[model samples]
Target: MPLSDDALDQLFREARTHSAWLPKPVDDALLRQLFSLAAMGPTSANSSPGRFVFVKSAEAKAQLKPALSPGNVEKTMAAPVTVIVGMDMAFYDYLPKLFPHTDARSWFVGNDDLIRATAQRNSSLQGAYLIMAARSLGLDAGPMSGFDAAKVDETFFAGTTIKSNFLINLGYGDHAKLHARNPRLSFDEAARIA
Candidate 1:
């Protein structure tokens, strides 16, 4: 369902990082809609490198359990779904079409360092887009990085060059789980004009 302006503001500005979730599942249809919306967000040269793996079932969730920090384990396990946000290291393979004007593929080829940096940076941006997209769709987000990356890679990305960048718990969040909103720096404190 498309949100109203008030709903959008509440979802984006007032939404909290919920550690607990109600027992509500995130269906594939919803995920499809989320990706459809989030994919429209810009990426450098249209690299669109983000990849998502929705861990929903017991078996799949088990693969992620060991990677989570103890503090995050219970909440993540309780959430209806957790999404592994990853990036394809070979994102440039599609660049001929994604950035047709230049030799974009050549920009990444043989440059492991460049590929790594670009994939991580772009994919993280896409992850943020995913969070906003979920909120727009009336879902809550708990973007987390408190996990063992190596363990996640072993369990989820085995046999693939995709690397796990972050995880997000998805569901109807329990508002009681939220902490108070923290303060933000003022414009003068955070920005500067040239």
Candidate 2:
């Protein structure tokens, strides 16, 4: 559906991170469309570092079970899908074309520190893009930081440079279960002009 101004406001302005979900499944085609939109969002050096692992099956969610905090386990497992947002530490390897006219790829290859930093920064940006993308596609999101990073790495990223950034549960949410919208800081409270 085309997003009207009111629709855009409804998607972001009033959106909540839903902890409870309806049983409706997010179809594969819609998931693909969501990603197709999200991947086009910008990243530094065009180093698209984000790699998503969509955990939909019972078997996959089982693998993710040990990584969750006790409080997060049931809600996450009950969702239709839990996305594993990851960052490729070697994301800059493709920067020859991604950020051409400079040796940006060389900038990260030698410095483990720089590579890690850029991967994390860019991947986090991608995760935000994922949230907006999901909202635009009419899916409710529950992004969570309550998980064991080490266990997630062991279960999902073993033998790879990809590291888990966070997890986001995706599905049709039950509006009846939503909490009242929480307060947000105003611009004066959050930002300052130098």
Candidate 3:
């Protein structure tokens, strides 16, 4: 059966990108649950390249501060948890476990162009899944790509194959601080039947 309208509202229709948060902290268990839900989403060759870094500690948040753009600094720093959605470039190494039925790893090994494109694209899909998972779990998300990615990488993923894709601030949002909803493109303007 399809999900109810209330579920649709919770996941999409009524969800908003939150910039202001309540004073409560998000539990680590909830973060783990969110990732578990997001990981179930489909990826090419089942190569789930998404790697996440939950910057929840004061020290981690401080480390992330310099990388954020001026406009993002205040809201991000104030957030309970800021997730660094990342792509693991060496993700094909896990194809044996993720796609055991076929030799999928061979498809990407030594293919730099394919690796970069696939990793970036699939990780972005995983990140969107994460946002939806957060909303489903009664949390708010503010996903952004406005930060200095290189700095975030150097600070958080040095000597690792994982590269930051985007940031998502997660928490209970203060709806009173939100602005009016903006417009979106209509189906006619964005879609076509082939």
* Per-residue alpha-carbon lDDT of candidate 3 for residues 109-190, written as tens digits (9 for 90 to 100): 9999999999999999999999999999999999998999999999999999999999999999999999999989998999
Stretches of model 1 off by over 4 angstroms after superposition: 1-8
What Cα-based lDDT does every candidate model obtain? 0.91, 0.90, 0.97
| TM-score, ranked from best to worst | 3, 2, 1
- TM-score per prediction, in order, is 0.93, 0.94, 0.99
The sequence of per-residue lDDT tens digits that candidate 1 reaches over residues 27-72 is 8999999989989899998998898998999999998999999999
Better of 2 and 3 by lDDT: 3
Q: What range of 10 consecutive residues in model 1 has the weakest lDDT sum? A: 8-17
Q: Pick the candidate with the highest TM-score.
A: 3
Mark the regions of model 3 whose C-alpha exceeds 4 Å error after superposition.
none
Give the true-structure RMSD of model 1: 2.4
* Residue 7 CA displacement from its true place in model 1, Å: 4.5
Error of 2 at 70 (Å): 0.8
- Extract clashing residue pairs from model 1: none
